[model samples]
Target: MSDLIHKDPTCFPVLEAAGLPSAFLDAIMDGVLCSAEAIMCIPQCLDALCLNNNGLQAVRDRNALRCFVKILTSRTYLRALTGETPGSLSTGLDELMRHASSLRGPGVDMVIEILNAILKIGSGVDASFSSSEPASCSTPLWKLMLTGAIR
Candidate 1:
């Protein structure tokens, strides 16, 4: 979470930073905002935190990291990202996993599977994608688990 927040400000330090392209910043902003929305919707905040961490780890580029974090922590953006909600669990985590699994694409099913594993492990599990390929694959899935979109 700290990584995301700390890096977020760089998304747009100035209207014209010269080196920092507007298009790149825009893309990062979109990804960050999307991630935040996913986090808030999910019941498990901790899981969201974990996912942010995992995303941070997945990419080593400092600029990209900063953009992702900035979008996530932006209060104005976060509210819009979550949108209006009655605050109710319309679906279980398992169902979400099934849906994620059903999706066809590279990294799509993998993301869902990872989230399901995270829900099962909860915070008690301490692992990183660097530790193992299987573990790395699970990180994004865990983030999804936090969203409560998967069982």
Candidate 2:
């Protein structure tokens, strides 16, 4: 039984089709694997999109910022940040910060633009706000700061 399973190449199971070339079958399997990999890479792909100029523009846009603020205001935002949310959409934001240091050429420029956008967002807070208002220390921007993302 061990020989049949391990040493006997003739006994090994293989995908078979009537007229398909072996290479074609291999290509099909590769495509399936690659698709699965791409699905698993949603966070990285989203970060890539968000790091580009269009994404940066979207981030800097006032309307987009307003939408972002609304989402962050939710109680689940913290859980999402901590990667505690159930599902396939947990945070991979730390990857963006990690990439910030290793980027070059246009990548560096894009990162700078993103950081500038974030700084503008941070600076938008009024210095004269009432003390009765809740602190923003736990917000996503604050978490970015706490993580030394600026450095």
Candidate 3:
């Protein structure tokens, strides 16, 4: 059906299990990317990314981290911050550091939590632990691990 083929799916936090329709996907993707700057706030957009198991899955499943990487590594932002394309990680960090002067308060707290999660994952903590139906706890451990990377 045309409607199904061109479904205007909402972006993250309202994900579709069905993969995107190839025919019109690029337009939708471009639209989402165009609006990404508005959602760069740590407490708002990134907060939603680190919310829970569903959120973690969304990041892993939806390739949200890659999207962030692209946004952060874009040439414009990189030039604004670093003046040259140093390398991969450096490119992203350059953009991340662009806002370094303004990062504070809750943003700082959020970054700390993210760093902790990244450290745990770096130190052999399983990144996908919670998605496997592990325990009876209200929260899943895997999500906690992903908080750093996705957010």
Q: List lDDT for all candidates, in order.
A: 0.34, 0.35, 0.36
lDDT for model 1, please: 0.34
Residue-level lDDT tens digits of model 3 in 1-151? 1223124313432343443322123332353333323323311332333333454344334433333333332322322222232243344434443433233333344446556645554454735322444333333233334443323
Which residue pairs show collisions in model 2? none
Q: In model 2, which regions exceed 4 Å deviation?
A: 1-40, 43-79, 84-103, 125-151
Error of 2 at 80 (Å): 3.8
TM-score of predicted structure 3: 0.27
**TM-score winner:** 3
TM-score of each model, in listed order? 0.21, 0.26, 0.27
| Ten residues in sequence with the least summed lDDT for candidate 1 | 43-52
Residue 93 Cα positional deviation in candidate 3, in Å, after optimal superposition: 11
Off by over 4 Å in 1: 1-31, 34-103, 113-117, 120-123, 127-151
Candidates ranked, most accurate by TM-score first: 3, 2, 1
- Which candidate, 1 or 3, would have the higher TM-score against the true structure? 3
What's model 2's TM-score? 0.26
